[model samples]
Target: MKLFVFDLDFTIWNAGGTWCDSTHPPFAWKEGKLKDQENRWIYLYPEVKEILSELKAEGHMIAIASRTNAPTIAKQLLHMFEIDHFFDAREIYPGSKLTHFDRIMKELKVAKNDIVFFDDEYRNVEDIRSIGIESVLVTNGLTKDLVKPYLTRTIARDLPQSEAC
Candidate 1:
């Protein structure tokens, strides 16, 4: 199965144009909203859960490759959303996208060609592509339709050269 990696922050949850403060305690999930210590609300994009669920159900390995400084809070948020269990690997920390993917590939034992990444940043898309991984830029956040073409293309590309025709 292919490994699918994702970014957090704007890519998963809407942080309201702000980075999650590493100093704040973990967020609290209540009545479908995640609130910080100061009661600032953060929400997962509406389509994230459904897309992730479908990918997991299809036997693809899901993972997180966030550059959030607040790694602890990121983990808490994932668990709060109840989607943490879907991830088979996670590389959450403050670092370059290259470092994040390097660790993720090593931990998962997957090659660059076998992985697909989704991020909301253009620079990240470029970085991932430089390493031979297929990446999708999630401008308005992830949706099933946005991901389908990449999956189809990757599957076809991985086919034997003779069979690709």
Candidate 2:
């Protein structure tokens, strides 16, 4: 099975250039908005929920790999948004993307080649790709068009070149 892993902050939601810091406290779902202690709103980008739902409906396993320092706030936001159940595995914390992928791969018992990772950061994308996993740099966040190609290309790319012909 193909495993889809995504980064949290910029990739999943718009944290407004400032992540949840100690003073910000955990996020709360209030009046249909996700707000921190200081009432800063965080919102999911366009098509994020639909794309993730589509992936899940297609039987792809979803997971998270975030470098956010405020994991509690991240998890709370995920829960508040009601999309946390879509993920089968998660490695959310402040660390290298490689470490996150390594742990995810082990937990899921999936090979590196069977995983597709998405992150807004180029450095994270490059770092994850260096370990043999297919990685996409999501500059504009997750969208159906961006993720569709990977979903369709999964089987063909995993096949031996000679046999794929």
TM-score for all predictions? Answer: 0.84, 0.85
**C-alpha lDDT of all candidate models, in order:** 0.81, 0.82
For model 2 the TM-score comes to 0.85
Expressed as tens digits, the lDDT of each residue in 6-117 for candidate 2 is 9987788887566544427566778887777788888898898988887887788999999888788788778878899999998888979888888888898988878898
Per residue, candidate 1 scores C-alpha lDDT tens digits across 69-135 of 7888888877877888888988988878899888888888988878999899998899989988899
Stretches > 4 Å off in candidate 2:
153-165
Candidate No. with top TM-score: 2
Model 2 steric clash total: 0
Clashes of each: 0, 0
Q: Provide the global lDDT of candidate 2 against the true structure.
A: 0.82
